[model samples]
Target chain A: MSRLFVAMGLVLLVGASLSIGVADLWAADIDAGLVMAVSRVPRTVAAVLAGAGLALAGVVVQLSVQNRLVEPSLTGTPEAAMLGLLGITLFAPGSALLVKMGVAAAAALVGTTGFFVLATRVPQRDPILLPLVGLIYGGILGAATLWLAWATDLVQYLGTWTSGEFSGVLRGRYEVLWLIAGLAGLLWLVADRITLLSLGESHARSLGLDYRATRLLGLVIVSLVVAAVVVTVGTLPFVGLVVPNIVSRLRGDNLRTNLPFIAGLGGALILAADVLGRVVRYPYEIPAGTVFSVFGAAAFLWLLNAPRRPAHG
Target chain B: MTFETCNLSITRDGVPVLEGIDLSLPPGGITAIIGPNGAGKSTLLHAMAGLLSPHAGAVRLNGRDLSGIQPGERARSLALLTQDQGVTARLTVADLIAFGRWPHHQGRPGHEDRAAVADAIETFDLGPLAARTLDALSGGQRQRAFVAMAYAQTTPWILLDEPLSALDPRYAHDIMRRLHDLSRTGPDARSVVIVVHDLGVTARFADRVIGLKDGKLFGAGETGDLMTSDWLTRLYDTPMEVAEVGGRKIPFAA
Candidate 1:
């Protein structure tokens, strides 16, 4: 399918999903402007930001690690963010939103760095080994979060983070996710430097690129992106993993050229998932994260079993 | 301009890979660094490119310390190609070659960059495979494209680490010939410092030779003076023979 047409379709779907909700939002009796301003617009914006951020994060992880199978969620960034959020929410319950986000982002940076270090140690690039290690690493972090939550009886608060559901998103609550847009812009600025990352450290250094600095910058961006998404609308599993893969397959790995398409497709996929969640159970919405997982897991399975293409590597 | 190493020493994991290395490599023709495995050949190349910082001493480019030069400036002066040029991303050969211009244009490629890329493709005979992804090509073809990338850098100095290590004699000789021509032809001729394994190619193509063994310089001089069987055997710690062929010398392990 043509990218332009697909893009147009996504924009249309986003528009349609906003106007057509469970409550007849456009009905004459209803305050359509208020409805759009308060609930619909915020939800749509949050979904797009979270999706785009995760997708960009995924590309960064894959590039920095030089492995396509890894993503921010797999690298324990989101789980670590959850732990940070849980701690802040329990201990400093009255903390400002920014404080909470800052704490979460710091934890995320540390966790992602840990994953990056671990990736370097396991030099066997067996394709599957790295991602599996990441999955296990993330699982351990997640278990820690779960155990801590259980001990503190704060497991209920963890609900919003485990699965992304934009139903709760409203005007002032979702503004922090705008930071993802800013971070994405930052990533676009350094896309070429980040692309050098996939070529390996020694090679990048040989090219006059500051290999350590660029890699650190990429990790910082990935951590902040994952933190913003997780703290806001919760963990949107596989959005990063799946969106960037599809975009790279369709386009290529030239980060500068493909950043927009990746952002667009990421936005489209999550918005579509949200729309599907809404319509699949009218008057009762499934979380966008849940909806995406079903599709994402299937796509991942297909990707794994698919006949390997010579041109891919 | 001349590239020189002055008492350079480098260590890896508390053990030295290169120690007290000093040599002057004059710009113009091919210079081959030949040694048995684990002789700090790659380490020396990396340090010259400033990819590795020495534990002590310095590398001077035209009498200026390499450490003092910025990485960006260093890159514009010389382009280094490593032995294992493994790329995970699905990049077309054109994209890969164009990346050589990253230091010059830095993402926003200009007409000159494009022209250099085209010239490199033509020079390396990669026109047929330009659009193809690196994974789609055979090992030799892929290597040719990699060499083209280093050429497209348009730097005055080119440092290649065993680019022809895995190729057949035909492919090896083919690359050597192109590199030989490149170093000799244009006004903006590039000086090449290659970590070469094939002794015959080195004797034929290299104007200067630097022999290394056990993290130290074994010998350094004009190719004629360095290619003797006595120096060659001592360098490798094995018997070697040099035979005259077509009015040129070819050394082989005996």
Candidate 2:
């Protein structure tokens, strides 16, 4: 039932995304197929891919740390990726796109690992403290990244990539987003292991899981996902954090059962946001990141204040 | 077959928790490890289950060195349930129990794995609540679900740390009764070792007792010998008494 609704909604969102762009496909002067192939399709695909990637990344990080509030955006991942991109742009301005993404991913891994170290030190009595710590950590890294960009006179380049809009995505340019599809597939294979991670270290180890190795694997996947999203479409805040929480609340946290819904809802929600951004101002557009930020902040607050069901109930 | 620890000592950050403890447990009975708070009962149980490496000596399962076995193989040999199991609010009874079979199937559970899960569910009488999430259940129900998960592993030995710490008498007795039956029934009965806090429940259900005091082994013998008023009083460093009613010895503070 819910799956059917989600699928139908996805189809409708895709159609709206394809038709609502500035180029009126119905006009006789326009080559509808070419425009659809080159721009609209890539933009829609990028939105779905980035959204799904972020959501999956969020699930892994949440399970790995055994905390629901933290996500890649909170963990300095995007800031670190931006720093790597900045460094690469300064040293080898003409580096290939793949090389840039590789450097960004490596840097993201280091930044996320640093956050995990800090996370262990922070007392976990209050559920909200971890994300607060992560937020402050990410902010500091973001400040450093901004300072570097300003010093290097590449603030404009940083601004353009980091805003997370799909306006510039085209047929060949957005191909990197397909890596998410492969990563999603990999996640499916390891879905059960990731679920076991939520049992905490002792229980997971008792169940024969290599806790450290599995956590490292999850961290690597999160870093790659964050890097890919940041490299291709800047930062999509709250997609990772918001989508998984809503799905887990409605359903449950069994990753094997909930992975598809999380990925689908994430993709659908972001694509819907993109479509809304396109249609809201007609010929002009808002970045999906900006549009999602408005909705995501509202959702975050609701989730924060929402009364948790009584454990006895 | 017997489980033996030879000169086992565990130190956490250079502070010894269990020091040079040597004991051998005979197979196929409920062996209750009891002591005062921070007496390293849980640490001894963890060391036996291979969670903590001994600083001075070794733990042996039958004849093989416990730490020499691979983690997957060790899980198949024995199952351990810690007191603090962390967050399980999102998992259903069935889902949580099915994780017990992870050692056998890794990620790809087959027909036998499913059968084992079903067996555990039935054994623990959790059929109606199998689909219910952990948060919806009471404390006793959640504890049963975790024990069932450990049971689903189908190992020969099961070790639990404080399985009945916060439970009321009824729930505590209910769990103990089930564990008692599990440790004594059929040809494939499991050897159950538990770090228990309630001396009354331990006396009623445990066939044998291992007493620890100040991180040292104080006594090891049959429950009949170990659960006497004087023995327990000495072990816990407080006055205690035992009364016999209907062929059962019940311990209480004097």
DockQ score for candidate 1 = 0.55
Worst 10 residues of 1 chain B by lDDT: B130-139
Model 2: DockQ vs. true structure: 0.62
Give candidate 2 misplaced runs (Cα > 4 Å): none
User: How does model 1 score by TM-score?
Assistant: 0.96
**In model 2, which residue pairs have backbone atoms overlapping below 3 Å?**
none
TM-score of each: 0.96, 0.97
Q: Can you write out model 2's per-residue Cα lDDT over A220-265, one digit (the tens) per residue?
A: 8898888888888888999999999998888879999888898999
Across B162-222, the per-residue lDDT of candidate 1 in tens digits comes to 9998788999999999999999886788999999999999999999999999999899999
Alpha-carbon error at A56 in model 1, in Å? Answer: 0.9
